[model samples]
Target: MNKPDPIPARLAALKTTPTPDLKQQWRDLFDSEPPPFNRRYLESRLAYRIQELAYGGLKPETIRRLERLGEELDGGDRSKRSVRLDRDRPITGTRLLREWQGVEQIVTVTADGFEWQGRPYKSLSAIARAITGTRWNGWVFFGLKNHRGRT
Candidate 1:
């Protein structure tokens, strides 16, 4: 099941604001120089901060649980970083599947990149966008990242 966003309407409205306005909004909310990220990133982080201030941040227990999960996912050495995982970290030899436009899509993981329909892709996001005709975080589209935890 998916958890509902705490401030859906406000988040939805943020998408329409101008870029300059978004930068100002980020400064207003975070009280610091905003990271040089795109509008989508800015809006998403600002929305999170807004909700965090209003309804309180994530519960301590939830944070601990996520931390433990992260360690487990990283093979118990959380400090050791995998250079290949700087972005999407699909396990090699794993098969990724998705359904788009009522069709099942298949992708195979390789050491260098993801393979889709005999073609090699640099990133899963590229494959996902190719399949869907829209920008998508390949991990999220392939169910590797849960929808409920997006915000």
Candidate 2:
């Protein structure tokens, strides 16, 4: 097989990167709390950061286009990749996991909703809140959205 694209491969690696490592990176980059999102979210944002430093990020036209498609992006050409509206959201049976205080928490996507600890929940926010004891936007909590523009 042909060699994988280095950027995408690095992006994918973000999924399994250690939480403490990512957390330290977060501290170095943002100087704030690392949002309680899952690994995939962290990887995507970090990959964007890496790419922004290497190749220029999204074009302004792309950002405007994505805005029209109901997604917001940083107007600045930083940390964004190509935006494709046709892309599908994470599908059924996708397993999202995060490590919290030395315990691993898992959530699985289902057709109607999400499953956590063997029970069906209406939203990931519910699960996030249950996990952190604070109300959270599940999408952000799980890194379905980025902490900044164009991520």
Task: Assess the local accuracy of residue 142 in candidate 1 as a C-alpha lDDT between 0 and 100.
Answer: 71
Clashes of 1: 0
**Best model number under TM-score:** 1
lDDT of each structure?
0.76, 0.72
RMSD of each: 10.2, 9.1
lDDT of 2 by residue, 63-140 (tens): 888776653455555445454212444579988877666676888989998999999998888999999999987766
Q: Which pairs clash in model 1?
A: none
TM-score of each: 0.48, 0.46
lDDT for each residue of candidate 1 in 68-101, tens digit (9 for 90 to 100):
9888888888555544343546679987766565
